[model samples]
Each structure stands twice: as structure tokens, then as C-alpha cells.
Target: MAQKIIGMLGGMSWKSSAEYYRLVNEGVRDRLGGLHSAQCLMWSFDFDDIAVLQREDRWNDAADLMVEAAQRLERGGADFLIICTNTMHKAYDRLRAAVDLPLLHIADPTAERIKADGHKRVGLLGTAFTMEQDFYKGRLADLHGLDVIVPDATDRATVHRIIYDELVQGKVEAASRDAYRAVIGRLVAAGAEAIILGCTEIMLLVGPEDSPVPLYDTTGLHAAAAVELALG
Candidate 1:
């Protein structure tokens, strides 16, 4: 049988969507020792639509958008689908319900990595929605027992603004990077042994260097896992 094609449901900025594409292909090449890449079917939104829905908290409508993209990929012959944004995952269950393709859960796989390494306490850095909402936190605390930490209210606003306004807009200002470094420092000081880069775009702005503590790049990890599944 030919390799099963992976489908990416993207356009959660399309910037991070670019990262998913590069990493998925690179990871596949690394494992298979050639120019191999996960055969992928991808569709991207305009980002304006996704942004407005996110800002207004129209989660069901946003999920509908993703489900529509996923259905299109299915019709195009994709085997499994992954939504590239961590924030977009807020609508995971609803999207999964609307589409027939298997929706790979990024949080679970990243959480499993934390658990496998015996990291009991982890700090999370993402959009305000992912940090403050029940969807992401409940899964980390209840499902995995991996205690999750987050920045304070002021810092939360900083990270949220930086992500949506600056980073997603493709301006990776050094000041914004320093701002995130400060937040990571505080999280570690508060007893986080590792920090989860809950947003896919974050790794682009700050990598392992900005943190003294262990850093889990969820974007890289998730794409690597998707490559693994596609190759198998």
C-alpha cells in the first residue's frame, strides 16, 4: 500500500501553518533517511475570518470553519487530520464531531511526553483563551495529573497581545521575545520544571535558549508525531 496521506487543517495565522509544513516534512526525512515527507493534504483559511471568530469567542462557528476544511481534505483523499493551532484546539471536540477523519490531539501527545519524562509540574504559555479556559486546563490536570501553571493576569494579557497582534502578524520583535522570557522565568521560579509552549507560533519567537528550565516545543513535537503516524 502507498503511504497514508496526512491532512493539515490550518490557517490559524498561516504563519504557524508554515511551520507545521516545514517540520512535518523535515521530521519525515530524518526518520526515513531520504527526501521522504509525509504526504499531506492542506487547506488554509484567510486568517481574518479565524481571527474575528476567535476575538469574538464564536467557538462553534470557528469549529464549523475547521470542520468544513477537514471535510474538504477528506474529499481530497486525506487519511487523518490535524488542526495546527493550539488555540484552535479549543474547538476540537466540535470539529471532530462534524468531520469523519481522526482528529489528532496535540495536547495529549505533548502531555504524554511530560508524563513519560516524569515531569510532575509544568507551566503553560499560550493565548489567554488556552490558559484561562477550561478546555485545555481540565485536560492537563484531570486527564494527566500533570499540574499546570500559568502567568499572572497582567502577564497573561501581555502574552495574549504579543501572540495575536505581533507574532501572528509576522513581526517577531526582540522586545516581545524578552517579554516571554520574563514570563518563562517567573513560571520556573514558581516551581515549573518544564514549560509547555502551548502556542505553535511561540517556538518561532522563543526557543530553548529563552528558558533556563526544560522547554517543550509543542509545535515541533506535534508535527514530529504526525510525521510518525503518516510514515507508519
Candidate 2:
């Protein structure tokens, strides 16, 4: 098979975008070897526009912008599009509606892996949209038949703070990690066999060590799925 080209809709925050770029490229290199990393066509948005979308929760509007972006990628010769940020994926449907290119949805792979690993109930941590909306979780339940759990109001607030104020803003603090570990512990005590680090930024703050349950890093899962399609 010929090498595939993937496009990234990035810059929701550049931090996670950097991780996706590194992970997809590195995944490709490791598979094919000889410096044959992923062939990516990237279109990054400005922080200002992203911030506005985040603040207002204007998901459809935000996704429409990305639809244009993905269409441009299609024109630029990319075979598919990856929304580099988890929160931004809230508009995934809009982008899918707007484009003909195949978009490898991140939540499905995570859900499939969760089922394959024999996990029934999994706790989720992500931005407000993914946590509150039925889009990702509904897909997991309806499509994959996986049970998904999210943090309560209080824990969700703390997790959101840790992601937006600390991780996304680039303030990585040890204290932040401890706070998140406490959240993970609570989720596990509530019967979560595995914890889904649904936010890419959360993976940086809390790793598997912090979780009493298994940690499913959404960033890594998303990257691995991207590699599977891009390198097929």
C-alpha cells in the first residue's frame, strides 16, 4: 500500500498539538522505520479564535471553521483529518458533514480498546464539552456498548481547572498532580476499573501511577489510532 497523508486541525492550544505532531510522526517512524514519519498537512488556528470558542461554548460555529480547514487540507492532498484537541472534537459531526475525507474519530478507538481490555465502566476526564455532551460517550455506549463514567460536579470543576489554568497555560505543578490523583482515587472507589484521561493535557498532570485504576491516556489512544489509519 502507498503511504497515507493525514491532515491535522490544530492550535486549540499548541501544547497538545505539539504532542499529536510528535506522536503521529514517531508512531509512523517506528512502524515503517528509516525516518518514515507521518506525512501531515497541518493548518493551525490562532489562539484568539480558539479562546473565544472555548469561552462561549460555540461548538457548531467552531467546528464550521474547522470544516473549512479540513476542506483546505483535502485540497492540499491530505487523505484525512485529525482534530488535534479533544475539546475541539465536540464539533466533529459538523466537520464530518462538511468534508468528504475520512476523519478517524478518537472516542471510538478508546471505547473499542476499553472493551477489548475487558473494562465495563471507565471514568472520564476532559474539558466541559466532552464530559457534558452525549456525543463521545453516546458513541461509546451505542456504537461500542461500553459503559462510561464522568466525574461529579465538584471533581469535574477541579479537573477542568487543572487542564485550563495549569496544563494548557503551561504551568505544570507537582501540587496539581496530587490534586488530580485525589480525583482519580475517588473515581476508582466509585467502581471505575479504568480511568480515561480524556483531555490530552490531563495525561501530563496525572499518569498511571496516580490512578488506582488503569489509566487510559486519550492522547496516546488517539495517536495510535491515527497511526493505524495513516500508516495502513
Candidate 3:
């Protein structure tokens, strides 16, 4: 059997999408020897438009846009799909229904790692939409049986602002990093055993060394999973 082609719908910020591309191809190369990389197709979106729809609570429209993107990937001969953003997965059902190709959920790989590590509770850090919404936390709790904690309202606002104003723009500041550590501290105080870097762009700001507990980089995990599926 031929290796499956991985399809990604990304560029929600381009910051994390760039990481996904590098990680996916790197994973393939590491496993398959020199010169081998993922046979991948990517559909990058305009983050400006998606952000406007999200800000206005027009997820139906956002979902419609993703569905169209997924169809294009499918037509381009993609065997499986990856949404590439945690917040965007809010439209998972709609996007999945519109395409026949298997769509990998970013949460699944994170949950799998958490479960394997015997962590019953975890903290989640991501965009306000991903943190505040049930699409992500609910999936971890309901589907994977993990307790999830998010930053409080104030901290959530700080995190969200840092993501858009700093991280997505490719700017990393010491103060912003400190702010993230403080929020992670709060989650740790709330009994979180591990932390999920739910936003792909988040790993840029906070990483394993920054956290007291184990840090799960969702982008790396998701990309690794895509490589596994592609190789098989």
C-alpha cells in the first residue's frame, strides 16, 4: 500500500501552521531516512476573516468555510485531514460531515498521551475561544476522562490578548511569558497534574521547561500522529 497523503487546513495565524509543516515533514524524515518527507497538502486560510466570524459568534459561517477547504483537500487527493488549530476544531462535526476523509482531532493525541502518563487531571491553555468553549475541554473530560482547568476570567483575557497581540504576530515577550507561567501556576494550585498547550501557537510562548508539570505540545503530538498514519 502507498503512504497516505496528509491534508492540513491551517494558516489561522500562520505562526503555528509553519510549525506544523516543519514538524510533519521532520517526523516523516526521521522515520523514513534521508530525503523523505510527508506527502502533504495544505489549505491556508485568511485569519482576518476567520477571526471576524469568530468574534461575532458566526461559527456556522466559519464551519462552512472549513468545509469548503476540506473539500478542496479531498479533491487534491488527501487521504486524511488535520484542522491544525485547537479553536477551529469547534467546527469539527460540520467539517467532518462535509468530507469523507478521516479528520484527526488535535485533542485526541493529547488525551492519549495524558492517559498513558496516568494523569487524571490537566490544565488547558489556548485562545479564549478554545479555553472558554466546550469543544476542547469537554472532549478531554467526556471522551478521555480527564479533569481540565482553564485560567480564570481575568487570566483568560490576558492569555487571549497575548496570543493575538504577541504570539500570532511572531512576537514573544518576557512579560507575556511571565504572565503565562503565573496562569499555569494557578492551574497547578487548582490540582492540575499536567498542562496541554491547546493552542498550536502557545508552545512558542510556554514550553516544557516553563511548566512545573509535564507539558504536552499539541502541535508536535498531532504532527507525530499524522506521520504515523501516513507511514502505515
Candidate 4:
């Protein structure tokens, strides 16, 4: 089978983008054996610029930048597009509209995995934008019939802080990891059958070994799905 070219719009934080690249290549090697790696095209943005746009509430401008990135990937001969960051999926509609290339949404593959695991209620941990907005939870509930629970006000702030101040910058602290575990435990008590590490950086801090419930790492799930599409 000929490998399809996968286009990635990454570097919402380059740390997570690096994971996407690693997992995608590891997936290809595991499946094909013998020094195989994914054939991927990527356009990594300056996260600081995007962060500035978000802080200033210039979402349209941010969308314009993402669309430009996607279009560049398409022009570079990518068969499909994967926006590697979950938060950026906030611009999913606009990004899709701007590109002719098929986009594999991060939520779709994740919701599928959750449903397949027979989990009815899942806890989410991500940036404030992902938790507060309907772009993510709304899709899981409205489209996939899953119940989503997030941390309360206090925990939400902590999760958001840990993501940006530490994880995204490649700073993983033992204290932060412990804090995440506590938050996850609270969500479990609230009736979450599994925990969705919605932020790409969350996996760096906590994985299955560190969670009270089953941990669904969106980065790994997304990359595996990307590799499957690439190989098919």
C-alpha cells in the first residue's frame, strides 16, 4: 500500500508537536516493521504569536493564520490535514472551510475510542478554552452520546496553569503531576468511567500509570489514527 501524505498544523506548543511526530513515526514502524516512518508534512507556527492573538481575543485573525497554514500544506501535496492541537479545533469550522484537503478532527477519533471502551461518562482536562467552550464537549455529547465532566472552577484554573506555565515549555514538575492526579480523582468521584487527557501536553505529565481511571491520551490516539489513514 502506498502511504498517503499527512499534513499537520502544529506547534500550538512545539513540545506536543514533537510527540505527534514521534508517535506517528513509531506507529508506522510498529505496523510496517523495518525502519519505516510516516510520510508527513508539517507547518509549525510561532506559538507566541497565536497566544498573543488569543489573549487579545482576535480569534478571526488567528483563524486566518491557521487557514493560511492549512492551505500551504494542501499546496504542498498533502492528502489530508490534521490540526495537532486540541484547542485550535476551536477554529475547526473555519479551518475546514479554508482548505480543500480532508481534515481529520481530533475529537472524532477520541470520541470513537471512548465509546468503544464502553465509557458513558468521561472526565476532561485541557486548556480553559477547551473546557469552557462547546467545540470539544459539545461534540462528544451532541455527536457521540458521551457524558463529559470537567474540573470545577478552582481545578480548572490549576489545569490551565500547569498546561501553559509548565508542560508546554517542557517543564514537568512532580508537584504538578500530583495535582493532576488529585483533580482526576475528583472527577472520578463525580462519575467519570475514564479520563480524557484532552490537552496534548497532559500526557507528558500524567499517563495511564498515574491515573485512577483509564487514561485516554488524545495525542497518541490522534497520531495512531493519522498513521492508519496514512498507511491505508
Candidate 5:
């Protein structure tokens, strides 16, 4: 079978986008063996401009940018689209409306993983918008029948701050890791069966060891799912 070309709409921060590229290529090689790599096209953005729109509450503007990128990927011969960042998924509906290609939403695979593991309740750690808004958590609850929990307001701020201020820039501090561990601990205490590193960048800061329960890395799951679709 001919491999489908995966369309990657990324660079909400290039750090996580790089991980997606590596993981997709590695997945293809591991499955198809020796020298095989993902058939993919990437349209990376200048996230600084995207961030400015986000901060200014110009979501429509941000969505416009996403639409433009997705359209570019479609024209470039991509069979489907994957938006690499969790937060940017807030604009998902708009992008979907604007593009003709199928979109592999980042949340669906993560929710499936959690359910497959027999987890009904999971904690999410991501940018403030993902946690506070309905776009992501609502999708888990509405579409997947999963109970999603997030840290308290204070911890949410900490998570959001570290994402934009540190992780996105490729800075990973032990102190930030420790802070995340503490947040994960609290979420577990609050009856979280597992933790979802909902932000792509959060996986860079914390992992399974930091949480008492299982840790789901959205970035990894999303990439693997893309590979499955591309090669299936």
C-alpha cells in the first residue's frame, strides 16, 4: 500500500514540533524496518506571532493563521492534517471548517489510551487555555466519556507560566520539574487515575516517575496515531 502523506501543522513552539517529526520518522522506521521514514509535510509557524494573538485574545485571528497553514499543507499533497500543539486546538473547529483534509485531533488518541488502560478519571496539565477552556477538556468529556481533572487555579498558573516562559524556549529546569511533580501529586490525591501531559511541552518537564499514576504524553500518542493513519 502506498503510504499517506501526513500533514503536520505545527510550531506553536518549535520544540515540540521537533519531537513530533522525530517520533513520526522513528515510528515508520521501527514498523517498516531499515531506512523507512514517515511520508509527511510540515508547515511550521513563527509561534511568537501566534502567541501575540493568543495573549491579545484574538482567537479568530489565530484561527485564521491556522486555517492558512492547513490550506497550505493540503495544497502540498498532504492526505490528512495534525495540529501539533494542544493549545492551538482551541482553533480546531475553524481549521476543520477551512480545510478539506481530515484532521487527527490530538485529544482523541490520548483519550483512547486512557480508556484502554481502564482509567475513567484523568488529570490534565497544559497551557492555561486548554485546562480552563472547553475545547479540550470538553472534547474528552463530551466525545470520549472521560472525566478530566485539572490542578487548582494556582497550579494552573504555574503550569501555564512554565510552558510559555521556559519549556517552549527549550529550557527545562529541575525546579520546574519538581513543581510539576508536586502538582501531579495533588491531582492524584484528588482521585486522578492517571495524568495527561496535555501540553506537548509538559512531557519535556515530567514523566511517569513524577506521577504516582500513569502519565500520558499527548505528543507521543498523537505522533503514533498519525503514523498508523499514514501507513495503515
Candidate 6:
């Protein structure tokens, strides 16, 4: 069987993008044994530029940028696309329309895993845009039949701050990890059966041990799904 090339639209932080690259390659090697690696292409962005657009709430501009990147991947002969950030999936519809390749949405595999685990209610932790917007959580609810919950406004702000101020910059302080553990506690109190580390960078901060319930890392799940499609 021939492997399909995975196109990664990344560099929303480059830190998490690096994880995606590692996880995808590791997945392929695990599936195919020694000396195997993923067939993949990547077009990374200057995250600073995207950050400015996100802060200004210029979603259309962000969408345009995403479309441009997806087109580049298509022209480079990518078989499918994976936008590496959960927040940027706000522009997913535009990217999907602009490109010929199938886009592997970050939320789909997360939702699927949550459902497969028999979890109907889950908590989400991500950038403010992903948490507060309709693009990600809405899709989980509307398309996947899962009930998604987010942190309160204050916790949401903390999650957003930690992502931009520390995680994205590759800073992983124990204080931030403790803060996230507290947040996860609250979500579990609120009847969340599982937690979705909705931001790719979040896997850097907390994991299953940090929570009483299950923790789903979108980067790992998304990359694993990409490998499946590439190898299947």
C-alpha cells in the first residue's frame, strides 16, 4: 500500500507544530516498524502575524491567510490537510472551500475519541477564541453529538493568558500546571466526564495524571488520525 502525504498547516506557535510533526512520525513508525516515518509536508506561519489578527478579531483576514496556506499545500501535492491549531479552525470552512485536499479538522478526532470512550460531556481548555467561539465547541455539539463545556469567564481568561504568555513561547512553569489542575478540578465538579486539551500547546502543561477524568490531547489524537488516513 502507498502512503499519502500529510500536509500540516502549522506554526500557530511552532512549539505545538513541532509536537505534531513528532507525533505523526512516531505514529507511522509504530505502525510500520523500524526505519519508517510519515510522508508529510508542512507550511508554517509567522505566529506573531496571526496573533495580531486574532487579537484584533479580524477573522476574515485570518481566514484569508489560512486559505493561502492551504492552497500552497495543495500545489505542493499534499493528499490531506491538518491545521495545527484549534483556535484557527475558526477559519476551517474557508480553508476547506479554498483547497482541493481534505482538511482533517482538529475537533473531529477529539470528538470521536470522546464519544468512543462513552463520554457525552467533556470540558475544553484552549485559547479564548476556541472556547468562546462557535467554530470548535459548536462543531463538537452539532456534528458529533457531544456536550462541550468550558471554564468560567475568569478561568477562561487564565487559560487564554497562560497559552499566549507562557505555553506558546515554550515556557512551562509549575505554577501554570497547578493552575490548570485547579481548572480541571472545577470542570470535573461541574460533571465533566472527560477533559479535552483543546489547544495543541496544552499537552505541554497538563495530562491525564493532572485530572481525575480522562484527558484528550488534540494534537496527539489529530496526528494519530492523520497517520491512519495516510497509511490506510
Of 1 and 2, the candidate ahead on lDDT is: 1
Residue range with the least summed lDDT across 10 consecutive positions in model 2 = 54-63
Better of 2 and 5 by TM-score: 5
lDDT of 4 by residue, 11-47 (tens): 9999999999999999999999998889999999999
Better lDDT candidate (3, 6): 6
Please estimate how well model 2 matches the true structure, expressed as its whole-model Cα lDDT.
0.83
lDDT for position 136 in model 1 = 89
Query: What's the best-to-worst order under lDDT?
Result: 5, 6, 4, 3, 1, 2
Error of 2 at 48 (Å): 3.3
Query: Using Cα atoms with residue i matched to residue i, what is each candidate's TM-score against the true structure?
Result: 0.96, 0.95, 0.98, 0.98, 0.99, 0.99
The C-alpha stretches of model 1 lying farther than 4 A from their native spots are none
lDDT of 5 by residue, 135-183 (tens): 9999999999999999999999999999999999999999999999999
Query: Taking the tens digit of each residue's C-alpha lDDT, what string does model 2 give over 1-232?
Result: 4767888888767788888899998998889889587888889888578768768877667777888888999999999888877777777888888888888888877887888899999888887777878987787788887778888898888888878788887788998888888888888888899988887777777777787788888788988898899877
What is every candidate's alpha-carbon RMSD to the true fold? Answer: 1.2, 1.3, 0.9, 0.8, 0.7, 0.7
What TM-score does structure 2 among the candidates reach?
0.95
Cα lDDT of model 3 by residue, 1-232, tens digit: 3679999999888999999999999998899888888899999998998999999999999999999999999999999999989899999999888999899999999899999999998999999999998998999999999999998999999999998888889999999999999999999999999999989999998877788999999999999999999998
Candidate 1 C-alpha lDDT tens digits along 1-232: 2567889988887899999999998887788776676689889889999889888979889888887888899899999988898988888888788778788888988998998988989999999999999798889899899899899999999999999988888889999999999999999999999999999888879988899988998888889889878877
> What are the lDDT figures for the candidates, one per model?
0.88, 0.83, 0.92, 0.93, 0.94, 0.94
TM-score of 4: 0.98
lDDT of 6 at 89: 91
TM-score of 1: 0.96
